[model samples]
Target chain A: MAVSRGFVGRRPTDSARVPPGQYVTRDFPVLSAGPTPYTPLDTWDFTVRGLVNRPVSWSWQAFRALPHENITVDIHCVTKWTKLDTTWSGVSLDTLLDAAPTQASHALAFCDGGYTTNVPLADLRGGKAWVVDEYDGQPLDPEHGGPARLLVPHLYFWKSAKWIRGLELRQADQPGFWEMFGYHNYGDPWKEQRYQGD
Target chain B: MVSKTVETPRVTTIAVAIQDWPGHRAGQHVDVRLTAPDGYQTERSYSIGSAPEDAYVSLTVERLDDGEVSPYLVDELRPGDEIELRGPVGGYFAWDNELGGPLFLVAGGSGLVPFRSMLRHHRASGSRVPVRLLCSARSLELLIYREELIKLAADDLVDVSVTLTREAPDDWRGYRGRIDPALLAGCRHGCFGA
Candidate 1:
């Protein structure tokens, strides 16, 4: 299938949209997030392709059927909030790739809404990442990447692709959303990997 | 910067209706957190886009394609929902009058959010520190803080220079490109707040 347009380099523009001090929430969400998701499982479709000798596509059911496992861990974002004691369930990318047999050295992930992040297959294997399908025993909610999402616990939260579509196995790696916009491509919370220059 | 973690709100953005907002300096940000359905929680640090005088915090977020926690904060979030956040994170990035100089703010996309507070502080206290901003976006329509930025420019409170990457056929007459030094140099220094 045709891929959506990737983040293209564009000249920058500026706006003083809202007045300063006006948005100061007496209280703020503990997280930096996009609009809450409205993902519906019936509406979800996950695909994995690229550089692999054979690309694989899995429907939600087909995806869940592949394998199921649960793990509890802490995740940190470069933005600096660390959430601990989180339980997530899903199929491991390594386990899945074990069957698919990826010949590609590099990997780029794409999501349902067409966002992409470049990563290394080595990072995936080394990080003990997975394509998580469930959270806290119940099937994951759509807003939380219901059907499935990529969970890279070691890297910053941005590495966790929401509404994940598939993996594009490439010979080389590429940066994802925040990376293209100047966030550090390899986000390590321990090192405070927030900005590109950082 | 002092911070205390709170609970995630039902909505993403809110009026920050809590009484007695903790005092914070301009150009500071509060760290926010939220709990996912499965008890998995996520956190992100955002610039306190509002000035200390303002009643609430406002964050302008562009949905990241795979932002595990961000999408909920940006898209599904609304005002009046409960959420968790810690006050006024980051010290150096925060604006301090003591730093003492005309301020030139350059922001890329949502990066401009924190600078908003700086402008407001300057405006309220009459800092007169010569503030200028170079905001870069793909198009004029996509410009955030469009109305406010223009008003500030018009009022001579701040010197605003804008560059558009993708111009509409009808809107290509002015500043048709990236922010070059020329744009920065041309901006008349406007300063009311330090």
Candidate 2:
């Protein structure tokens, strides 16, 4: 069981690109709390509700009709894996928010299998977040939050909820599935906010 | 670090005693760092197999021929050795007493470590959570904690079943093939029906 490789320890080369306590990974690892959900696009829908004056809903056809931005960004997960130069195309949160104006300060992205992750309204707006359905110029894989998932590259990948179905606007911050357990309320990878009270 | 062979020639359970170790939840993992004498360092995350109720924090490592860290952990590491480690990391992939009942666990090969912690915790806490574990391993010899799992299952605290991917001993009563829908359904029926 002896492996002989002239091994050199990993050290952060570019601090600005890779966050502290994080390592760059070329392959996209599949990390999920549970099993992947496969919901047919024919019945898929997206909704923006909660603190909005009037909630708006979009069927699969209608959601795809919205203007989309082609983005290539770096994503960091709390598990210490960072995928760089990833590309995606989806409707920006600003566009979805514009359609249903809200006075809320917080947004919780709710998805299939009762998964939810909270993010500030400011984080979602101003081209910071997107409800993405396309990855690498192809339809999103269900295993990777296909049909659509929230893409907030600024925060930990868990904040970008997979299989996203709706956005629940809130006046107060609320913890989601992982957050309620022990994950940091705001998973800022740069700060290495992995566990609670970090 | 105190090392003991668990699944035999390849898998070893390393127990490291840390002072003032902040207790961990069942099914959590830790990041272990190994520093070469020349100061070259490598770290990898491993699931905790010792229950939170246990006195020492332990990790079970299976030597992967291509792994940079595991080979040293399984073959070279010995008792009274010192290594740099951090954690009780990853709060998301964990379970506890408060989150109770009808626990369903499925493990593929060495993936059984975390679930072992959960099962041990369930037994230690005296929680009556109905647990069913389906361990898919190459064979009985390759399965870690085989004896312990059998004892636990015999005690009726947990229902354990195995699916062998490679080869099973002739007259193997469990399963002889890869996990399919039928195997899963049979496990469910066996557990719930009884």
Candidate 3:
């Protein structure tokens, strides 16, 4: 998306990198549909279930015990802000999937307050996604999906649910809250899929 | 586009009745794009000010001296004008009465637009959800939707508090400073826990 409005001044070089309709911003705008949720760490848990013969669950300690990775990537929010070269440390979705193998082709990430977003299983595997708990060497702030959030840097940020608690594999794709409300089911920033049928 | 002055000269309410509104939850916003005759277009997003149940979608815009869109939107646009728009966008910051119970709203300047939608929805739906709104403005004159908010607060279901940062009336009885821990704590007891 190439935004050339006066507010989003454009240069030739910018079009080569930033996705269509997205402007690069040094500031990370805090955009939430509702109030920030505060879930105590002691009560937090991560689970992998649905369509799997044997489901897996992890307490906060158990999840932290898994192998972790430090990653640096750029993230784009569907609301049109892009933060580049962000660093995060967490357990990769690949590692989580390997723990409890499944044959399902789609996944529904379940978060606190019943928020869920569906993604193709392929987009999640191969080092593309992670359950991130730390940002820039600090515990992720609750404002930014604190305890842990699904990090799918390749897609629009809404697919990366905050306060995420689990991933439920499924045989069929089920659109999440935003998806059901006209947001693109598969939000690819490069395509500028901000809404359904975009 | 239909425009009305909501607060001061810089603040104006723009309403449009489109066939595809589909209705939106309170606190949702729409992205608007304005195009010049030569097709040079600029887009900015604004919070929708009308309740979801209203017949038309509306946005309250605050004109900035240097802003490209707001200047034209606030000063040049007239009734029956056309502009491009998309949205009712974002899921992270939306609320409806269905979320149930106590709602605490905090506003700074034009930030009151989305919360206005929430309040309207609450009143229109006859919801009994306890709502407390803490609004911070430069002064009473700049407060948007003042009359409606006052009317809403007349009901036991709603509570309204205002803090004047720049200028306060001589007889002001409300908060006289900016939002701080003390004021936020007051908002917490009877409203949303956080």
Candidate 4:
């Protein structure tokens, strides 16, 4: 390893909480591949389709009527910023997936801006993920995927597709926007898997 | 590192020579990793500043008051120091001359870094894409590539408009305040066919 001269990292007191090559950040950094889409709540809806016994869809009003949970979780961005204890409220993927039974093992999360990210159905089940519309007691801003966004806290934040629309269950796994590029298919920060070959 | 240039008060551009670097496209980024003497390592992604035609990879870093890596990159590391970096990664945002245009690019602060690569690629490739750029910075003094942007604007095919959000010089003659829909509409009108 090439040691940088006179460079000492933040050296977080709780080092174990931070993944390797990552640092803690209090401020939320907004990163987007394109302009933020402003989808009116009335037209916004969430769906679960493809490889399911029966497709399911929920309009904004109906989705909000579903049981919601307040969650505080650590979000790790592949950019190396880890914001811990971020609070959010949303309907769990299990609640939505339970409504539509599927034996498929993977899903391609499609968003409003033509952006997509793939996640294992297993990761989306068991309350591991949610389609969040609220962050920190306020309606999520359009820039932060207001209306709704998929929240998969375990993987890199990019996998948490903003402006999330629906999940298309797939029999085989495939690459999404960043994954088609150089980013790793499964971005696990703990393993330092950032690039395709990493 | 081959050379370093101070772009602004808080920004510095560092060019490094890479061995067998597989040249990158415009708007690509690289992951820069730095290790401490105690074996502690940290990494951050930075947009590539140099055009693909350039001989070396250049990265423009903006110093953040509390940033773990930016401060060290902007203020400390010197030429000839070895730093580990990966890629020219992220193709989702990359641009190439083949894409063709009426291209419209908008950037604020350090966000202009990648567009600089695109604009350079635009010029170097001799692409006659009618390009319009609307850049925003806190002030003229804080603007990166101020001189180069002026030179690029001289091209009949390229139009560069800057907006100073916070402060502007007494003689400044450009847009002011944050980018609003009206400004965007005007910019869009200039590039895209009405």
Highest-scoring model, DockQ? 4
Alpha carbon lDDT of each predicted model: 0.63, 0.84, 0.84, 0.90
TM-scores of all models?
A: 0.47, 0.85, 0.79, 0.95
Quality of candidate 1's docking, in CAPRI categories? incorrect
Clashing pairs in 4: none
Report RMSD (Å) for each prediction in the order shown.
17.2, 4.2, 4.9, 2.6
List the TM values for chain B, per candidate: 0.80, 0.93, 0.93, 0.95
Docking band of candidate 3: incorrect
Whichever of 2 and 3 has more lDDT, that candidate is: 2
Give the DockQ-based CAPRI class for model 4: medium
DockQ of model 3, rounded to 2 decimals:
0.18
lDDT tens readout by residue for model 2, A1-198: 122233344566677899876777888988777778989888999999989888999999999999989999999988778899999999999999998887899998899878999999999988899999999999999899998999999999999999999999999999998998778999998777877888
Winner on DockQ (1 vs 2): 2
Which stretches of candidate 1 lie above 4 Å from their native place? A1-40, B1-194
Query: TM-score of predicted model 3?
Result: 0.79
> Any residue pairs clashing in model 2, and if so which?
none
Task: List model 1 lDDT by residue over A1-198, tens digit each.
Answer: 111121121111211321111121212123323444566666666666776666677766677787777889666655444556579988888776775676788778887666677767887884389989777788777677656778988777778887778888877677776577656778766555666665
Model 3 alpha-carbon miss at residue A141, Å: 1.4
Off by over 4 Å in 4: B188-194
**Model 2: per-residue Cα lDDT at residue A108:** 89
Native contacts kept, each candidate: 0.08, 0.12, 0.00, 0.92
